[model samples]
Target: MERDRNLMRDILLTLALILAIDAVVVGVFALLAYPWLTFVHAPIAAVVGTTAAPVARWLVVFLPVLALFVWAQLRFTRQELLADVPAGDATRDTHPDLHARFVRLCKQADMQPPDLAVVDRDVPNSFAVGGVTNATVVVSEGLRDALSDDELDAVLAHELAHVKNRDATVMTLASFLPALVSDDRKILNVDGGANLLVWFVLTFVLYLLASPSLPGALFSVSSVVGFVTLVAISVLGGGIILGVLTAPVVLLSRRLSESREFVADRAGAVLVGDPSALVTALEKLSDRGFELPDTDARTHYTGVDGLCFLPYGLDDTDASTDEDTFTVETRSHPPTHERVANLRALVDEL
Candidate 1:
């Protein structure tokens, strides 16, 4: 296809991010487990000398992490991807008209029709998952009720473009990294608040385990206070170090994600031969969007924000108060104004 360059570059970049995340996990766990790794160190030293033992220790942690990542990616089939994100099956038998429209669009793009899914919600949003042969387009009940037929087709075309360019699959693959440090499946920053809390607890437990005199802490209040301070210091110090290492991956993912939306906007317009329809669809969805509730389903939705028509289910929960910047860019999807502007530009060209 004409998009070969963009697709290849994104795939390479996603691979780099996956490797980098694995390295970070190994480095952190290795540092924490260093003292206890002495037994491992001794065996390696006996075979490869003391100088190489440290290198071997890191490899010991790294290899398993890399293996698990490879295994996980291979095993993450369409079934696994759809498991947490619940939806009802949509077939030609159930929705003949929708399927006919879908088939026509696929013919326009010279691709086969993907599987379809629908949700019975009042929200007018949609998302796509998997890629190529396994791809599935998911829509809400309110989407059909809210949009006119042309605007709805434009939105459908947009998601198909995502699948066509394989960006949906790329983002889906990249999501597994953030999912590692977080159970929330939040792509950006990986739910730092909860992960940090886990770090603190684990650090505290280790502090007690590594204590020089556990008997003293049994009676002394000062000893209890000292341990708390020590744990906090260690966790804080580690966060600073780890954050520096992870910043590149986060920034790159953000840049790629925003760019893909623009790419999909243009491609979708070309696919459907109607850019203005998509423009109106984008505006209506953003203007009338509702915040996603903080439920297990929301957690599932967060993982596939890049594929969703509205990022993170339109959950604009970011607190930009006091001009705080960290909470400003929570959504994996690009800003609405930017997307609209880009689509308008496409409308002019097409």
Candidate 2:
């Protein structure tokens, strides 16, 4: 009950944060593109200082547009991926049995059936993408060949839990803010930043030119301080805006992802009614070395790798060291050893 409540809280928080970030992104875009809508008819105030009203007004108009875009993108992208890659032949080898068992598990969890795809790649991997019932569950052929029925069911249930929880879409939406902030940084550098730097330098030159003519030291000091303060505020404000805009989205995404992985692991175990089988699968997969052909070192492993049954690829500790968790950071999936340890602990608890 506690776990379920926490999950509910996380889901609500995730939705709220996504919606907030969506609004912020739209507002920022509109403020950038249409300055007049937000502009106030204050000629005297404008002459003295630029008002923030125009920026505020632009945000009000952009929120709905951005929300629609996010929904449409997630909806259509899932359909396209599913259409291009038809469901794997359940009749092919053990996949059919795996599919039947997975369906049973989904039903037990009260989830609508998710589309499943099998990849012929050598890596032992599986990923769940999409939201609600429109989810896609993908597994590499290597994964099917590597585990027993119960173990496979556990893995599929884990992936299905991801679908039931709508984790993929949440993560994608969460990531949008960071991407937007990063892009906004570029825009500020190109537009706001460049202009400010030019003005600051020009103002310094002008002050120096007029410095000799000032009648008092107080006037000179005040002039220099005022100019420097203006430049400082511009840079600081832009950076603050960028950080404030992205932090909630990123943090919420991470929190939801972490929680969902744990929930999925438990749900998967229950789905097969065999926590030990899931444990066995995790142990086996941990021993099997895996690597993606072209994935970058920074690729997110998260839940996808958290349930894998083995370590993959050649035993080269020095291959990739950029991951936050130095052990499993080499590939898309998290480190097999750590995952195995965690699962074993989870099994003991159950």
Candidate 3:
């Protein structure tokens, strides 16, 4: 019954967050469209001496933005998949036993077996990547070395749960708008150089279109003031717009991520019929003091810290300080103690 309740909660939370992210993306589109509608298109229409319907103008603006959004989604998805593939030296092709174990686990979980790889890192971590058909499960060398056979099976089950749930795809889709806005901001900045040359050209074209009707010289005081004001508004308004659209989506994504972790834990525990093994795995992974090498640490943290069995570098204990409390609250995974307790309760019920 508790499992069912958690399953329901996960469904509800996932739906809510997905809807929230959709709304945010739509809101950003509307915000972006307004400037084109009121400023750019209006001026263009005036110059053309034709009044286009508001709906038509909105559609014109919306189509391109929608195209870009789709493109970004595809681009990010591909990048994530590529990122999941092990480097040349990190491949686990020689480990047929591990591969067979993963295949067996997938059969038990009723999920298609994901491609598997082993990272050379000693971080004792694992993560899942890719969409449903192309998903891959990556485990660290340190993790395989650290855990017992049952514990390793439990960890694999956990990663398989992520693949089965399609969490990576869901997360990527949820993060689409944030990524787009961030990347667009970089493109809009002058410092982006050759990469944003097309944007600069577009800006130049707009300037040409707007300048013809103005009375003052291009560098006149009035023109300078107008340009500065426009820049200020773009900076401030863009910040506000991005913040409003991003904050809720990001927060909700994080919440959904945490909820998914719980669901995965439950699902993985059931898959193995050994919640205690998962509990032991989580405890071992949590308490392991292995530090990632400096060269790989940043990439590891950004890539798979959230997907790991436990929060990286954090002990399976209650937060002792105010800062520690904040860190626990903000972490992608739930506190280890809570997760262990939950698994223990689940084991008891089983």
lDDT of 2 by residue, 82-136 (tens): 4433346353255666677767887898877776677665566576767544667
Question: Model 2: runs farther than 4 Å from truth?
Answer: 1-15, 33-60, 72-95, 179-244, 290-350
Q: Give one digit per residue, the lDDT tens place, for model 1 in 1-350.
A: 34536755774776577567656755675565454344566788898988988988777766775676556644553555566557788888987877788888888988877888887767677877774357888887888888999998998898888778776556644554444334343333335689888867876666555455332564377667666655565567655655555455555666666667777888888788888999999888777745544443312334344457876452245322343323212125667888898778766765
Per-prediction TM-score, please?
0.63, 0.59, 0.74
Q: Which ten residues in a row have the lowest lDDT in candidate 2?
A: 307-316
Give the CA lDDT, 0 to 100, for residue 24 in model 3: 56
What ranges in model 1 sit over 4 Å off? 1-22, 28-54, 69-85, 110-113, 131-134, 172-240, 243-250, 289-307, 312-330
Q: What is the model-wide C-alpha lDDT for candidate 1?
A: 0.66
Off by over 4 Å in 3: 14-18, 34-52, 78-93, 176-193, 196-199, 205-232, 290-301, 313-331
- Which residue pairs collide, candidate 1? none
Candidate number with greatest TM-score = 3
Decreasing lDDT order of the candidates: 1, 3, 2
Q: Candidate 3, residues 1-350: lDDT per residue as tens digits?
A: 86668766876776577666565565455554454345466655665545664555566666777677656565665345445435322324688778878888989987777778777766677777676358777777778889998989998998888888887777776666555455521323466578578777876664554453334788677765665555467567766776676767766666777777888888898999999999998888766764423333212233345555664522222323333221211126667788899899998898
> What lDDT does candidate 2 reach at residue 328?
18
* Each candidate: RMSD: 7.5, 10.4, 6.3
